[model samples]
Target: MTEKTYPKVGGRSAKITLVLLVIVYIFNFVDRQILSVLAEDIKADLN
Candidate 1:
């Protein structure tokens, strides 16, 4: 029987991708928080 091996996830490109994803996730979280905090004011101003 033959075994199949997969590539490891410890390369430079992998590291860069992980960092970028984390940064994007953090930015999205902060943006949502800010929007939630301002939702009432935005609605009031629009109305």
Candidate 2:
């Protein structure tokens, strides 16, 4: 029988990438929330 090799996981780069992605997602979520809250004001200002 031959031995099978598997790909490595849980590296430093992977951790950093995950953290950055989470930060970006958090910011995007907050931005949408703020926009929604100000939607009426924005519409009035644009007119």
TM per prediction? 0.78, 0.81
The runs of at least 3 residues in candidate 2 whose Cα sits more than 4 Å from the true structure, single-residue gaps closed, are 1-7
True-vs-predicted CA distance for residue 13, candidate 1, Å: 0.3
| Per-residue lDDT of candidate 1, residues 1-47 (tens digit) | 89999988589998999999999999999999999999999999999
Worst 10 residues of 1 by lDDT: 6-15
User: Which regions in candidate 1 have their CA more than 4 angstroms from the true location?
Assistant: 1-8
lDDT of 2 by residue, 9-47 (tens): 889999999999999999999999999999999999999
Q: TM-score for model 1?
A: 0.78
Residue 36 accuracy (lDDT) in model 1? 100
- What lDDT is obtained when candidate 2 is compared to the true structure? 0.98
Highest lDDT model number: 2
Native-to-model Cα distance after best TM-score fit, residue 30 in candidate 1, in Å? 0.3
The best candidate in terms of TM-score: 2
Model 1 steric clash pairs = none
Give candidate 1's root-mean-square deviation (CA, Å): 2.8
Scored against the true structure, residue 46 in model 1 reaches a CA lDDT of 100
Clashes (N, CA, C under 3 Å) per candidate: 0, 0
